[model samples]
Target: MTPVSSPYVPDVSRYTKRESRAVPVGPIQIGGGAPIVIQSMLTSDTMDTGACVREALDLVEAGCELVRITAPTVKDAANLRAIRDELRSRGCPVPLVADIHFKPEAAMEAARWVDKIRINPGNYADRKKFVVRSYTDEEYASAVARLEDAFLPLVHLCQERGIAMRIGTNHGSLSDRILNRYGDTPLGMVESALEYARICRKAGFHRIVFSMKASNPRIMISAYRRLIAVLQELGPDWNYPIHLGVTEAGDGEDGRVKSAVGIGALLADGIGDTIRVSLTEDSVREIPVAEALRALVEEFAGAPRPKEALVPPFDPFSFQRRHSHRWVRNAKVGGGEPVRVAVLEENFAALESASAGTEMVPELGYRPGMAEEVDPEDPATLAELETGAPRLVTVRDGCPYPPLYAFRMLAARIPSRHPILLKDTFFPGEKGDPLRERLNSALQVGALLCDGIGDAVLLRREADPKKALELSYNILQATGNRSFKADFVACPSCGRTLFNLQETTARIRAATGHLKGVKIAVMGCIVNGPGEMADADFGYVGGAPGKVNLYVGKKAVRFNIPQEQAVDSLIALIAEEGKWIDPPRS
Candidate 1:
């Protein structure tokens, strides 16, 4: 596959900051070289003015720069005026964004109230029926014409109301028209938004932001890169700010790892203007993750750009692990081996016991008596260790140097053949949770893994060791290094969902928790399920009320099964395909 090139010319800078025209949203600015903005959405019902105001205020207090509320109907859109009034009365005048799907009238009403309006291009004017049909040239043109007729009114309303607009394209939610035309790829995600962009430009509306989001980090990163290339081709005047996110990133460590891998990878390339870390947890909990990611971009923002390293051998557009010699026989890593996992424990007995039956490599701090383990921070000790010993080198957190720079320095000095373990520890100062710490660790360690630098990862915190181990593999999974458990890709429930997404996702995960090396996507609806779950081994999607659709790869093999029996049916399908293995006797 051809490597995707950066949109900007090659430079010494780590990221080629995509220059964009700053669009004003309320008192703050996005793009145009503004500091990367941090934003979050309120999960409270929009019609409940009190609850919406309280949540909006809470998010703003937690350092959220912008707040988004769902406006599913004309009434909900109109209710935003009341919510804004209550917030202003409370002396919290933060900018409000109305999230609209499939309702132009709601969008129009929202444009009149909120500081910005976000419309999903996949469902803004088109309904997703999961139908596959061919459209002739004239028919396609007519459809575009109808889309413009439906969307132009909102464009004009936003322009007149001085409200900015975000054309957010979700990987799982592309219109059937776009999917049929573009085959549900990154190109389709970009084209879906660009189609709306074309209409906006024709209507002379320029205060726009664009986002290409996906549950998969690779897809999200690739789509954003391709979108920038397409925008650059359109001309310099079309440089709209990008809002970065990984939608439906499930809760806790898994969510953080997934969000960081997708958002951090793009931000490292200097691609995002504003960011939202969409966790399945409380909306307020999302602020710290966003702040941590922003801190990463800021750390490099003003520093002198380092000289570009040797052109990497791997493709930038796609993921392919970098080649390195497989030096350690006991703990195999690099040279196309499955990425290893390492656990950092001060206790020798615990470390020894943990490594006995598993592939986990044990890492310890420097001490004279412990000859069996490797000291991750000290190069001299590592050099003295007997050749071929089961050594796992560590690059610790809170180093004097930047973490990635520290890793590079260690990599340069150590033998390239040795299996190195990357470690990150977060003590979320007061007022922070373990979730925030997990996100920080993921961002710190994940950055190196994305460049194919580490063999294994060790995420440490004051929390449970098991949680840390889980986080280690999650980071590996997010970076596409390894998968120790079934990968669950589910969307966070939205107004368009026909069923209870969170509850259903939990049911699916509970039933399949023991299946290793499998990928299952539990999607709330068909809007983007068939396409977004394209990489999944099997998919359980909401087809209709109390009905589920099952997929093997992208092909929907079973349609409209009762929701209550969906999990059993999915397992039966997996067993039929000979991919299911019974759990070991406990």
Candidate 2:
């Protein structure tokens, strides 16, 4: 399918508009806004000329605008030329890209066969011929520097021979300094690739494409967003073609979902010129998945996104910007305190009862029906919330007919200013029921589009009030906010279990129950549990059923506390740790 140019977008000056020297890959322009091109790689070894040709044909049929084949070794490079020849013989005119690793020789070899070449900075070293994982920052920097130098000759060749060069960064192969400073973050990946792009520009090479590859959807989206932001800031000179993909995305549902989220988010933002939905399964069938993602993104963008859904002004750096608003503490919150939210009924009595003697309205500045209202049940009403606004809604949690259809109607009538909030009981547990399933579907649909919704989220069982409290804390933490009191990370006991992970965790939670922004993890075994709980500020795990190992940031501070006193002992340790924060009042 040909890409339809968007009418409202002003001409982006970031890229050079010269079409004379540019390579036209089917209907898409590589060096221009020439409607985004979709590209995929051939997993088949190039030496298997027939396999390569067959894969290329399949990809082309699946709507792949361009196909890249791996050219890792010199022999593979020759196979690439044969496959390219076979493609032409079979009447498949899809543009071919050569996936090149660090070797300049390999790049130069494939430069003769493929339409485009992707050079990753993660491979090759200055003095050494090659090295895969250079763990040190200096080594990584040197590799990238060397990669830039090696790439110039290839870029020069591309310019001479009329092939495009894509500077790509793989998340798994990131340099030591980048990993140390950024820790598998998209910012680090974008910055690393940009550093190479800068080198290419300095060398006077303009035929460029950039990609930051990761299997994780979040990382992929984050990297692309950062790259676009940087490109926008750099002005027209930095605009180059961008290839989208979830690198090594596993097969089946996982691959599809990862590719959709990563590619979809970028496409909606008007980023990404080409895409590849890298999958582990048959490379032949990968084409349809990529096309599906493209179609889905286009369809989503085709739908009119409400302007009111844009995030409100705030710090631009946060992931919070995607939703278009930042929560700023108001005088009502006082001294920049965290916003306190209550999930209650929406009727006059409930609102009156819940809002009475509380700062929810005052902190947020509300007039009854002043901020636009939507049916708490509507899915569409949940999209595009302003930044930092805590959602408020009412749900008939206990009612049999929770008003699904009515909510849908109310959703369409909702004004953009307000987000939806529903009561907790509306959402059923993981166990399925029709009413519960419908609510979950609505909630997911709303959340997926960046719409905000709230529920006094339910727990598995209410018999143990402690379980409900713990569950609530977990829910708030998942949202990236931790204003809730005490999060307990406990594991389910298995045959390998040594201690009472459930009861012991409960006791610790009870002791620190009043403390907000604190997390305690309880695990079944001492061996892997402590290591897994490294992120927690404090943790305890069963060494044996009666003994426990205590930790603070992965450091084994205390060992083998008896089971009977384990909870109390951990509580005392927490009291000591509490000094790090201002002391809590009685």
Candidate 3:
């Protein structure tokens, strides 16, 4: 859960119980003051009437309030009727939604049978040649006008049929105008959807859901967050249901984790109305994943949970595989009894008690991990701050070996700013001056002060005969200090400190500015250097002149270096440790 500072908690709390205007579908009410709805789409061909019905029923059993079917062509659009009829015949009353691309006929066909229709404004505009393909102002306006006219009729048809509409904007199919304005950000997707949503509102149809989907989880999460923020400010009175999804969310576990993190983030903040866990694999896989993610919210809100009992009949067609029927039934049942899962406060106690099985009780309240009493004397205060700043620290490596270069390459590989910290400034007393005591004190104080103000700090260390830099970095990370800097551990070399240790260390530190929240170490003297540098995200040690040991965590990667050019070699190594720059002190 994203910890809310006291001040922002109210901002979030405002929406917690605020009722939204309901958007009605056969038996379900979306948007206006409804339960957080779980939804998914069928990957089976829509034209395969039997397959579509089977998938839809599966999703319904999984607890899906609605299921969207892709109607790419007029032929596919006809499946909506067959699918809806099949569901109704089977005693499943779930609403069917048609997802159409560009063809207006497809939309019309689905609108006749499906309860809802989702259309891409960009795609609709793409078919009608109005805009000059070449960038020209006069041609663009003319195209925009034609595009608006093209969608106005579809909006009118939806209004006439009393069909709900979702203006889904994909990252791939952005409007040229919006793309030019906002670039290809999730924001652009939001703006594009908003333009269509505005058209719908003007057409006197308030039944709407907006979706902005991206293949990238980070981009998807940020776009949704921003969209909610904008809607909160722009249409406080209007609570149109928002559809959540991670488009093209890969396949299997990789897809599941990404979608979970992205959707989970928004749902945790109480932003989503309906969620779809998009996966490249069969849409059937999407059902269970969506239900699980929504279950988190249920668990958090202390709402009724799905029955933990294994499927009684273990039927392959059981709804448990599609949606959490148990949870929804519990919600409908409304006895307000809690559901329980296995959670032991003390594993040792559970192990010790031979007769004890899993505790079966209702979820009463939030159980935070690692609860501890706050100590006033601790420099960092848990009291939430008003700043909406994130509380993440970067992890970087400051080793001066081949691994450092590996770190650098990784940093360069990332599209965004390397989040690890950079460590360049040497702490006082590295040379073992009598000032070592004062330096350690200064460093610790610096850490505490930075942490109190919500900063990520990096602990830079040296490669010595005894410890690895990663060990030091981990020790600091365990502090959960917002003021954490990447750990930079450098060696204290003497005239006998073999392998241009000083020069390599300094250059490695200089190279770390790009990365953030990293712990790196540069050490000399093979005999004790490797062991001395512990807890470093990356480590580079002086290993007999032309060779150096590079480490990620405690694992070493072998690298050969020429003794005469060891400093440059070390620089190359540290660079590979990715970005390990210290976060800016608060």
Candidate 4:
């Protein structure tokens, strides 16, 4: 099959930064060297006008530049008008975005009331039944024609109303046609959004943004990079501002770390214009995290230019683990070993106490016989290392050099066979919270891992060792280095979800949470479940009312099992496949 052509390029080195055309959304301007914008979504029912307005106001006050609300139907889309009117009346005139899925009419109606409209091309005019079929040239052309017929009105309407559109494509939600042709990969994601973008361009609708979202950071980062490459090939004028996000990132540390890895990886390459940290927690809490990520990206982007042109050691557009030699036999630090997690404490006692019950290595800056820790300012000290253990290099915030460049300089001075432990410290002080701290660490530390620079990561902050350990593993997981716990890839509940996603996810997690290295996806619907859970070891997806489907790596093994017995059935399937390990005796 011929590869699809994209309008953007993946060559980050070609441009000092990704220079995009400024797309105006209400009073806000995105891209074209503008400050990266922060965005969040409202979880309240759209029909509940007061609730929606209240959430929107809260989001704006929390530093959200753009607020999005779901519009699953025409009634919900119409309700946005009331929400917008109330917000405007109340002095909160933040740009509102209508999130549309499988509803073109809703998109048209939403275009009139909102500053921007976001539509999922996988389902806007196409139904995803996981059907697989080959389309002839005529059939494919007919499908495109039909899609244009359904989508053009909204395109024309948005253009006339000066409303920007985001052709956001979800990894799990690609149309059957796209999957049949592209096999549900990142290429499929780029093609899905490009189809709608081509339509928008033909209609002279240039005010558009594109996003390629996924639950998996690897897939998400790969898709966005591929989209850029395709877009660069399309034309200079086709450089649309890209929106960055990781869909269904679970709450707490996991969510923050995942969002940071996917969004931060692209941002490090200067690829994102607007970003939303999609956490399962209240949308208001997402703002600070997004703020921290943006700040970190800006810090790196504004770093002093290297004295000489430095090419990246690894491909920025693709995912490849850095090659290294293993350090220890039992605790492998590098050389195809899982990225290790270490705890950096103020003292040896504190490090030992914090890492007592875990496999996490403990390192102290001042302890003798411990791993060598060097400050970025003093590189000559690296030559004095007498111990053969991997060195623990601390790259604290407020360093004179950009973290990336500093790492490169350190690598140049050190021996190639010596594995290095990257420890990133953040002192948020009065300007940060737990969420901000988490995001900052992920961006700084996770960015290095994505670039294949670190073999182990130790995040140091003024928090307990347990929390730090959890965060270190999360960073490793997000960077696709390790999997500590059962990877729960659950979607944030939306209008299309048929069952109680949160409750079901909780139950599934309770039963299988102990299965380390096992990936189980709990999806709310079939729209993107099978395809989205492509990386999962097992899947529990909603099939119909009061029914569920069980999948083993994207292939359905059982159909329509009663929801009550679904969990047990899933466990049984896992055991039958020899992946089940019983919980230890309490």
> Which candidate has the highest TM-score of all?
4
| Candidate 3 Cα RMSD (Å) | 22.9
- Per residue, candidate 3 scores C-alpha lDDT tens digits across 229-251 of 56656656556777887664444
In candidate 4, clashing pairs total 14
User: Candidate 1: where is the Cα deviation over 4 Å?
Assistant: 1-17, 130-142, 302-304, 307-313, 343-349, 355-437, 451-454, 457-468, 493-508, 523-534, 537-586
In model 3, the runs with Cα more than 4 Å from the true position are 1-19, 127-140, 302-586
Error of 3 at 255 (Å): 1.5
Off by over 4 Å in 2: 1-28, 124-147, 180-183, 305-309, 312-586
The TM-score values for the models, in the order shown, are: 0.79, 0.54, 0.52, 0.84
lDDT of 1 by residue, 272-391 (tens): 999998775677888888888887676545544444342433344455554556645435555567666555435435656764654333433323222223333465765764365434
Kindly list the per-residue Cα lDDT of model 4 for residues 231-342, writing each as its tens digit: 7777789888999999878766778888988898788777899999877567798898888888877666666654444445555556677666777633556667777766
Any residue pairs clashing in model 1, and if so which?
172-528, 376-394
| Number of clashes recorded per candidate | 2, 12, 99, 14
Rate residue 581 of model 2 by lDDT. Answer: 43
Q: If the candidates were sorted by their TM-score against the true structure, best first, what order would they fall in? A: 4, 1, 2, 3
Query: Please, what are the lDDT tens digits per residue for candidate 2 over residues 1-586?
Result: 1112222122111111222124454335764546556777665556778877887788777777888876767778767788888889888778877776646787888898777788775553223221235367676666667666765777678877767788888665554555555655666677768776777678677778888776545455556656766675666666677777766444433344445555654554456677776654555566766555555444334443332332222222234312212223222221223323332222324444544642222123222442334433345554533343544433333333222222322333344233333323333343444322322332222222221223223222232333333333333343333344554444333323466544555566557755666766666564226433434677787776578887775566888888787776777787787623433544
Model 2 root-mean-square deviation: 14.0
